[model samples]
Target: MFFSKLSYTLGLCCLAAGTILQNGQVRTTNYPDIKIDVASYRFRTYDANATEISYKGRWDSKKVSWWSAPGLVFGFTGDTVAITFGDLTTDTTLVGYRIGGMDWSFTNVSAGATHLFVSSATPGVHETWPFNPLPFELRVTNWAYGVQIAQVHVAEGESLVRIPPHQRTIEFIGDSLSAGMYTSFEGLSSFAYGVGAGLGDTEYYVTAYPGICVSDQNCWGNPRGQAHQWFYTSDTSWRASTIWGDAPEPWDFERQETTPDIVVINLGTNDNNSANNVSTATYVDAYTKLIQGIHGKYPKAQVIVMQLWMGFYASGNSYAQNQGYEQELKDIVAYFNSDEYLSAPLVWDGATNTTTKLDAPSEPFVSYFSTRGIMQHNDIGPAWHPTDVGAIKVASHLSQFIKLTFGWELVATGPEIFHETLYWNDEQNY
Candidate 1:
């Protein structure tokens, strides 16, 4: 009878890898109760002795799978599942395992050191292994040292493959153009790494900060201020005391686990360069006290305040009191639409013209004082910021105004536009 139905499908793949290996541990029936923590990570230092980390996996796997040892070099480009951990000899830390039901962990990691342990599943199906291939067995430990994991993949599943409790979450505060700053200087396939590879396969949480500025100061010194940076940055270790102190108030957003249905605030170009500028009554009293401290930490999110595309006082004539700093940023969105306390309606002419025009200076310097003007142009990058095709046309116009005001579904396939010249040079050493 077809060899007894191929020996009952190889005895149900050896009783599903022996009920996902127990007693020694290695669970996951695809996601039964949700619990995967590796909660922190952040690494840098690329070649003083190699430290080029990259690990992404959210889905799409026609093949290629490995779990533990052999060092690193797994691959997959489309659904992104890249890993590159070359021989370091000195700084080394590794731990990765999977079974398939639920319960994973790995938090707030930065880089140079990290450790998360739990093990057991060793038996086969690493594409039917043989030459010394145990099913699974991770007991790993090293713990902490400079963690770096910037967004991992797979979060929850199986309620007919879940993922729709108002589409996970997302709260990206800004400044330094939502703190992507130079958007990783044209790399990781820019377009802010293709919107972090289309939200690193869902379940968002970016809490940005990159030269932060709304009016909390440090206009561009790079110390990250703007009333104390947040969205999430308590210690993903890149240290300097978590990127230059002060930013962890607003009652720590009542310790999140999920409380953001989109809150993207893109801070005024460093309060249009502070000093004698920030007025319109002090930029509407520090932008209504930072939108009342983000509505007292996300009272049903959905904030969205962005406008200023080509960085540093975004050219209106490159300042000289550029129309009173563009009418104090339109009176901070006209005081958030005359105090509706915003849930919507605050896109004050979302500027981004990317201006250009300068060429005419042959003779005009006879002991200066006045009488010689006409040299205006602006479009900066680097320390001045925004270039990776101007941060992919400001993330393709904020992903087409977040898919036309929240129909949300940015690029799984075009029409919301964001080619930005196919990532202009998608980062690698820029």
Candidate 2:
């Protein structure tokens, strides 16, 4: 059975008390429903390219399973704010928040133009009274389904104001690892710990496809293509590069918000899956194309091709004969870091193993680069994906890399970082 979850206290407040006399007469103000452009909010760690914006005046996110749109925070001032969206299938599960900080879930809701309202009062009771305009923020916990956000609204008489988006943004593109698959949900999934929590100020966008490859067919009998999930709305037969063409309705990227300053790619694990029979040269060529494509879209962005987390091949296969996937990733990084620039390229030679230190420094970035060091397989999740702790470990490594490479230092001793490290280290056997 499906259930809704709330992470904050639900204090009982009387609706009649919303407006009380203080100095003079009663004042009642109603604001118009504020239409927020979904493109205005930063996707944060999501693949901004894969997003389908302006699709019939909606923001439709087509991502893989387990992907969450976490950093979409917007502020509206009203007695009641309603989130309106279009289309909902059995696959869609939308979890959102209200002013009092309670989570309300909408599952298998409805299709085509539906509005879910969050009021200052409890559900099933409607008592309209006078109240001042208060700013409230709401966010979507997950987007496993293809749900299109049409607009955010307040009452017709109420006003809905817009909050500015975050400043620094990063996009993560890869397979299940980047998708936070099997990562703990509410401390149950393996990597449930907050790896991305430390970057609370920064917006993140994640575009990861489980069991997907950059160029070869997925080992799991899924789609077969390049990392087109980076540009398309959903993981379907549609090509992200061509979805705009031959469309009665098309998504315009020019209207989309947030061009990433940094892009992290963790692929090839599925490409190297034994069933694919892909060669190193072919893999490198596909990987190069993926980077080129991303750079082509955002020329000023920095790219980091991550090493595969597992040394094993697909479905009980080992990388013993294929010279190991770690070496292959290192080789790709070497090619990208070659003497293209006059200065000696900062190359990650796959030196460190799974765990990485916070202060670790990679080679200086010339162009887009690759990461070394194979992620640990011992601490994998039930589906053989990165555990919650493993995800944090990987995030920690990336956190370190981003800090050193971009000179963006993170708060190492903060509670988020400390507790994440402590809990993961104390529990993760891998």
Q: Which lDDT tens digits does candidate 2 get at residues 1-430?
A: 0001110011001111222111234434222233344344322221223132112112344311223433234444445554545433222333333332222322222234434345456442242222123334333333233344444455555554444445766766666555544343321121212334455455556655455677644444445444444554444322222333333122234554667678777677667666666777777766766665565455567777665545334445533212236666666666655654213222111111122222323332323333334344455544555545566666666676677778776642432332223332466666
lDDT of 1 at 364: 14
Residues 16-105 of candidate 1: C-alpha lDDT, one tens digit per residue: 232332222453333221223334322221221122211221100111111101111111111112122222211333233321211222
Each candidate's TM vs. the true structure? 0.26, 0.61
Off by over 4 Å in 1: 1-104, 107-171, 175-212, 216-263, 266-303, 306-406, 409-430
Provide the lowest-lDDT 10-residue window in model 1: 363-372
Runs of candidate 2 exceeding 4 Å displacement: 1-58, 61-72, 88-92, 96-117, 121-144, 186-197, 216-219, 237-253, 311-324, 341-378, 411-430
Q: Give per-residue lDDT, candidate 2, residue 198.
A: 52
Cα error, residue 420 of model 1, in Å, equals: 39
